[model samples]
Target chain A: EAGVTQFPSHSVIEKGQTVTLRCDPISGHDNLYWYRRVMGKEIKFLLHFVKESKQDESGMPNNRFLAERTGGTYSTLKVQPAELEDSGVYFCASSLTGRHSYEQYFGPGTRLTVT
Target chain B: AQSVTQPDIHITVSEGASLELRCNYSYGATPYLFWYVQSPGQGLQLLLKYFSGDTLVQGIKGFEAEFKRSQSSFNLRKPSVHWSDAAEYFCAVGLAYSGGGADGLTFGKGTHLIIQP
Candidate 1:
């Protein structure tokens, strides 16, 4: 089976511009999560989606960032009016279920650079 | 608040040597612990997890970790190190879904493992 896939492995955009990163989870996975690593920082959770429903979004930094998982299959994280500080790597992962014990499979991640 | 700490920022060991990476966590209740490895420009890969039972848990690539509740530590170990084992290892603590409803993982600043051929 193919693992989780992410598009545009790397992206570069100007400050105040918008960018959308996409992720396609593994087949039959019901739980999807978004995380990112800023420069010199640990990977931090952004949000989680369980079959098209937002389970937890506490880690989202601000309102300029939005994530959507339509049709419960793939997800897209859009950043509007992106700031220079938003440059980092964004990772997407999926799990077979939302249960606490299941392991999550991750994608290669998209590196976004805001100039 | 729940947090994870990886004491060593980096470690270098010769091939065929034993390796240990320390992890510490702070949470009110019994926390679910996990260890993940990431190669350069790659995504994180789950090595192993500790939920309940058997303090010693085996993971992929002959890696293992021991959970010690008394010390609030879960340290990853390997009997023999390989050149391919060079990567960044991260320790994370999973918070239970409760009244506070925190259902995500808190990760530690990873430890970069270096292998000398």
Candidate 2:
């Protein structure tokens, strides 16, 4: 089975511009998640989805960030009017839903640079 | 709120030497512990996990971690390190979900391992 894959491994955009990062999870996985790691900081959770419905979004930093999972297949994270502080590595992960399925497989991560 | 701490920012070990990376966690309830490694230009890979039961857990790549409830620590260890073992290691704690799946995780800043030959 393929692990999670992210698009545009690296992205460079000007401040105030919008950017969207996509993630294609492993086949048949129902749990999808987004996390971000700023330079010199720990990786932090952004949101989670279970079959197209958001399971938790408390970790979202602000209103400018948006995430969606359509048809329970893939996920997208959009940052509108991106700011310089939004520059970081965004990671997408997926896992199966079951009693013993506690492992979450991660993607290579998209490195976003906002100048 | 739950948090994880990797005390060592970086560690250097000679090849074939024993290795131990310290990790400390603070959580209200029982948490699901995990260790992950990321090589240059590679994604994070799960090394091992601790949900319950045995305190010592073996993982891929000949790595192991000991969970100590008394100390609130989960330290990763390797008896003999190799040159390829150089990478960044992360320690995380996941919230327990009622449905049995692990929820979002709280991660440490990570430790960079430098293996010397």
Candidate 3:
């Protein structure tokens, strides 16, 4: 099985610009999650998707950030009016359904630099 | 709320030396614990996890972690350090919510291990 894959390994955008990061999870995995890490900070969860429906979005930092998983497949995270503080690595992960497993397969991550 | 703390920011260990990385968590109830390793420019990889039963857990790469309820700690250990072990290690706590799915993990700042050859 293929591991999670992300697009545009690195991205650079000016402040106030919109940026979108994509993630293609492993086939047949029903759980998808998004996390980000800022400079000198721990990786923090942004949201989770069980198929096309969002299961949990409590960790989302703000309304400017939006995530969608259409047709229960790939996911996209959009950041509008990006700020300098938004520069960090965004990771996507997937896992099998039913089990509360900690073994989440992660992608290479997209490094976003907002200037 | 659940939270994890890794007191050590960085650690340097010579090849063949023993290694230990400390992790502490704060939660009202018992929380699932995990250790993840991340190589340079890579995403986090699961090293091991502790849910119940045995307090000691073994993981890949000859890694192991001991969960101590008394200390509220779950520390990762390796008998011998390898050059490839040089990377960032993160400790996380999984919170169980009343809702269906569990809550996202709460991670520590991470400990960067430097293995000297």
Candidate 4:
């Protein structure tokens, strides 16, 4: 089985520009999650999706950040008017369940650089 | 809020030497602990996990971690370090036990391991 895959391995854009990161979870996986790690910081949770429904989104940094999972297949994270502080590695993970303590498979991550 | 702390920012070990990386966590209940390794240009890979029962759990790549409830710690260890072991190690914690699915993880800043040949 193929692991979680992410698009646009690296993204470079100017401040105020918009960027979208995509993630394709493993086949038959119902739980998808988003996390980001800023330089010199820990990886922080962004949000989670159980199929097409949002299970939890308390980790979203601000209003400019938005996440969506369509058709319960893949997910996208959009940062509108990205800021310099927004530059970091965005990671997507998926698991068979949405409860807790189960291992999550992670992607290579999308490195976003907002200048 | 759940959180993890890795006291060592970086560690250097000679090839074939024993290795240990410290991890401390603060959570309300019995924490679900995990250790993951990130190679250069790669995603995080699970090394091992501690949920219940055994306090010491073995994982892939000859890695192991001991969960100490008294210390509120889950530390990773290896009997002998290999050059390929040079990577960033992250300690994460989760709440509850989900056999079917897992929730979002709270990760530490990570420890960069340096293997000297």
Arrange candidates by DockQ, descending: 2, 4, 3, 1
**Better lDDT candidate (2, 3):** 2
lDDT, candidate 2, residue B78?
100
DockQ top scorer: 2
Candidate 2: stretches off by over 4 Å: none
TM-score of 1: 0.95
Per-prediction TM-score: 0.95, 0.98, 0.96, 0.96
Query: Per-residue lDDT of A21-113 in model 4, one digit per residue for the tens?
Result: 999999998888999999999999999888999988989999999999989999999999999999999999998864432788899999999
DockQ-best of 3 and 4:
4
Q: In model 4, where do residues sit more than 4 Å from their true spots?
A: A98-101, B97-101
Cα deviation of A46 in candidate 2 (Å)? 0.5
Q: Show pairs that collide, candidate 4.
A: A97-B101, A98-B101
- Top candidate on lDDT is 2
True contacts kept of 4: 0.85
- In candidate 2 chain B, where is summed lDDT lowest over 10 consecutive residues? B95-104
Comparing to the true complex, what docking class would candidate 2 get?
A: high
Candidate 3 residues B1-117, lDDT tens each? 678999999999999999999999998787889999999978789999998999999999999999999889999999999899999999998765444445577899999999888
